[model samples]
Target: MIKELLEAKETDSFDELCVRLGNFLGIGKAVPPKVLLRAIDDPPFADNLIVCRNTPGFLQSLFDDPKTAQYDGDAGKKKEDGKSNTELIAKAATAFLKWGKAGFSTVDEATLERRENACLACPNLSEPKNKLQKLVAVKLDKERVGRRTGDKTCKICGCNVARKIKLPGESCPDSHPAIEGMTRWNEPQRVAAAVAE
Candidate 1:
């Protein structure tokens, strides 16, 4: 469904795409056309659209009531507690500091895929909860190295998983659930230290 919509983007007008999306989601009259168009064009919302296609009823919920959309799709799934705005800011600041320390260099393709795969399998991956977080997610989405459909924000560290995985300096906030001492995307030294500890 999302692939069809993306292909439609090549041939459909802005208004046409909005109507198609609304009709596809079965909420043609519920959401305004402009809002639907915005969702198609905006990164955070667009990503949600992709997610919605994969998870039934999510698109409707996202369009109907964005406030609860975060919880709607994963009602039965186990999710970690989300960070507060203050905590999110602190984490982002720390991540930037680490990135700066490493000269903002990106990891090689193999390393990037390894990190992204880890995030894809992690349960902490989640959707943007608010407009501010959506905006931040958009910026990070642009820097993404891999274009996987499962890409989303990391609930633990409040970074977009797709983008964070590519940064050489960034490390996973939590250890891999099955890997004992292994952090998902830690630098080699950090991994060694974690294993030692």
Candidate 2:
């Protein structure tokens, strides 16, 4: 679908592109033309669309539903994780630097198991369906972290669950969906202590 849209973008006028995108998203006329046009040029919007294409009716729910239009991709930003893609990237980079400075050490076995268990039960742990997601997973696979049977990518932070759980500096991005007031993995003590200072 993205390939087709990119091809169409070459020859289609702005209005034509808007119609094409609207039809593709199954939003019909719910989203305004200006919003649709913005979506066409929005990199994050395209990335989210591609990543979520496998989800049944997700695009329609995001683009067609009037209630979600304001917060979803219509504004060229989807804050599903309450963090932008750039922020997520920055967080990952910081984690990597911390891990490197700590001699590439991993968490204790118990901590790894706990984190892995949380991620295994998380709704955000998803299979890498798109090239971008698969690439990240492949890169992280080299870490050779002990992986469980159902290990997959965490959609919020774009990390491979199996590898991410082993990093001491890493923490869950959101609270557990079913567990009120509990983060999937509590913030690392080092980070929490720093924040308290």
Candidate 3:
């Protein structure tokens, strides 16, 4: 099914492809970029599948001018020193919390609703079949504070979209610059007074 979707050629844009995959997954919405990339990065899907052989380049072409080809490539490749994704999510969580401690609050109701709607429309909002169980069970606790692993998690940050989207400074981590605007956030600030206006 995935192969057919990729080869269909009717799904011209990344969002369109995501919608197709999401529909296939019964998600009825677009999947996050990270989730889509993970599909291309994993072994059975990309390494052995004939249709996904050139998925990386194919995804790259979806963007008019991608900021970094790295985004369209495999996501499972180890970074230098082989830091696990759990460690990476933890680090990002810490940074976000620190920003919170610096007096940031959740976004206004309108913004929160808009962002949440966007997340609800994302396929990555749901858990993946090949989810990183260990990490999902442990490190993602902060992000999943009010949600479960099988629920909505941002494939990029592994954060629950419900919580993250409500935050005043949260934003989508999608690599394609245009699609990254699912939500808006205030710049980093040290005082509450300087938060979103």
Candidate 4:
């Protein structure tokens, strides 16, 4: 029975699922693995076991751009190590899992509804609304257009580049010119114009 239940859920490795099921059933309280396994196999308890054992996921993906968020008052500057992102996501995922876990007990139907509501209400768990979703959405929309931007190298040095760069852009140094017209489209155009020598 445990075997079949394990097969049915298929969420993680069998060992991890077994640990989760054990944890759910209060196994450390003298519950033997075989006994717990048999109990889970019982057709009657299949749904219960599946619900208890499933791992909950994060509520929403993040807004990934570093630029706009730089000036946004809330959330402040994203840190260098990306710890801010991990911490924010960890909090949301933990709360969401907690909300789901509390649902399994005799916690009434209203309680479960409350968990769902609370998860939805959580700001971090909330769907990336407005500006947040726009970041990922625009990138995905570009991908769906079936063209690769091939934004891969420095036009000047022919070296692979992390970002678009030009000496005239104030991005180069303090004394560099402010390249107002330079855009991704200008990349090849400028390269062509320069290389004609």
TM-score of structure candidate 1:
0.41
Residue-level lDDT of model 3, residues 1-197, one tens digit each, is: 34325342421455555554444343446645554444433312221122222344433333222322344434333421355544434332332233323222466666655565556555556553332212222234334423323345667655545545554554565433243323223222234342221
Candidate order (TM-score): 1, 2, 3, 4
Best by TM-score: 1
- Model 4, range 22-111, lDDT digits (tens) per residue? 454433222223322332222112222333332322111111223323423332323223345344334323322432333333433443
Candidate 3 global TM-score: 0.31
lDDT of 4 at 140: 18
Off by over 4 Å in 3: 1-97, 100-104, 128-150, 175-197
Candidate 3: lDDT of 89? 40
State in Å the error of residue 101, model 1: 4.0
Model 2 per-residue lDDT tens digits across residues 100-181: 3332357998887778767767788788755444432424333333567133778886665665676565568777566665
- Per-model root-mean-square deviation over C-alphas: 14.9, 13.2, 18.5, 23.9
Per-residue lDDT of model 1, residues 89-125, tens digit only: 3432332233223333578999887887777777888
Question: Which portions of model 1 miss their true places by more than 4 Å?
Answer: 1-99, 138-145, 149-151, 186-197
Pairs that clash in candidate 1: none
Candidates in order, TM-scores: namely 0.41, 0.40, 0.31, 0.18
Q: Would you list the clashing residue pairs of candidate 3?
A: 30-123, 31-123
